[model samples]
Target: MLNRRQLITSLALSATVLALPAPGLAQPAPTTRIVVPFAAGGPIDVTARILAEAVKGTLGTVIVENRPGAGGNIGVGAVAKAAPDGLTLGIATTASHGINPWLFSKLPYDPAKDFAAVTQMLRVPNVLVMNADAAQRLNINSLADLITYAKANPAKLNYGSGGTGSAGHLAGEMFKNQAGIFALHIPYNGGNPAQLGLLSGQVDFNFDNLATAAPNIRSGKLKALAVTTTQRAAAMPDVPAISDTLPGFEIDTWWGLVVPAGTPVETVRKLNAAFTEALRSPEVKARFATLMAEPAPSTPEQFDAFMARERTKYERVVKLSGAKVD
Candidate 1:
């Protein structure tokens, strides 16, 4: 019933329709999981959540999971062992990547070999603080005063840290080495307990992360002497940097992203672009301001070099402090 030309045209059209892709058959977007090596509600965990939320539209269905234990080694080790598919990533901190290698007797994963750096996310400065009453009693109003008093009193002054090899501990030790002063070191189970020690006058002073100590400092329970960074913290502009008093003194607890070492370069680039965009967002910047942390996004190569430098610096601090987890 049909002419030959019409029949041929209909068959060709049918072939073209069948060759087109079906919408229902398209592959689903992969889910991304970001592991935080600290407990929920901590600074690193909070930062991870913020980043996950910011990147959701770009990266699709990103989630944050907390796996806290063994000074962040457990979660980081899990990430190190994850498939190098770029689906499982981690939020790495100064303690996890920089100090742990030197402090632990045996790390489950090698920092350099097991993971690829994505980008440095943020940097939080530690503050040197004393109990309000203690500072008033000792008439120490500044870092210089504390240093002079410690040099004069020697073992009379004591400092508290979260524990051995914590960023706070290493900061205290580094201060001691640079200042030529001696203050007895007291290691508590965690940062909160160490802060409690300082608040109750059990410890003379402490180096605490500004994120955790900002509330107390604002409430007048703690007196901030200086921030442990090269420059003054935006959150506490009135407080000077420790470097202002002790030339060339700086220690900051920074965090970044990393994936298993064998991940494809294209996948790493995609992640870096997403996170860097999030870091530059005004919303993320405002939230970080509330935490007294600064957004410090870096390229993958830059982050790798930064971590290497940090490792070298902390190795010296650990050796001088004689800190070991074994």
Candidate 2:
């Protein structure tokens, strides 16, 4: 009943309708929850917020949830029990994945079995910082100088840490073991207090997170002797690494993303891609610089392997230090 042009128009309309996706067939928008297993204001929480902001464009409705307590086990356990639909993810730190297993007598979730690695997010170096005045008095300008002074004074020099078995505590112990030097260890309730002790000269030095100590170091309140990492930190390139003096000495905190195990491989890949891309973006990189951290994106497989190595390393350190908690 129609002319040739009209018939062709009808056919085209039919084809277009057929090509359109059905309402229920289209993919629904995803709401992802990123759980941080630490207090809200700490480095891990800040990193989570930054990552949430960075990936919002690619992954819709990203949110960061803070669950602090029991040295990060409580929140991490919640993530382990989360639905493996890729909607629930968590930030895994060296403390959570590497240290806690050995530090604690029991954990609600197994770090190795409960979650699948999404990607490694960042790495933050620890710096050995001393009171500027104390360093000046001791004539200590480098790790070698610090070592020389500590060796000469044996137990006269004392270090402070957030607590027993913390990264700082372990780092100090490791240094003692590696350098064959002895110094007293003073534990504070938290890193801030430990750093305060260092500033007040209550303690001789601290293995402080570079981000937290950068301002003080810049302000000349604290003198950075060496970064705990084997390599110098980008945030403080002028500071040498402790390994330069004591070979094989390295201790730094790192964070990564993980999802509950049994998450679809495709979903994990998508998450890895989104986060890695976000980490690679200039804005995120700049922000990490401010935090004295480096964006270290990696594949799921790579992250898994890295965590395994970290666990083994921390186990040895914990054993060596005899650090244990209930």
Model 1 C-alpha lDDT per residue in residues 88-120, reported as the tens digit of each score: 999878988899999999998899899999999
Q: Would you list the clashing residue pairs of candidate 1?
A: none
lDDT of 2 at 139: 97
Error of 1 at 80 (Å): 1.1
What TM-score does candidate 2 reach?
A: 0.91
Q: Which ten residues in a row have the lowest lDDT in candidate 1?
A: 20-29
- Which consecutive 10 residues in model 2 have the weakest lDDT in total? 21-30
Model 2 segments more than 4 A misplaced: 1-28
What alpha-carbon RMSD in Å does predicted model 2 have with respect to the real structure? 6.9
The residue pairs in collision within model 2 are none
TM-score of every model? 0.91, 0.91
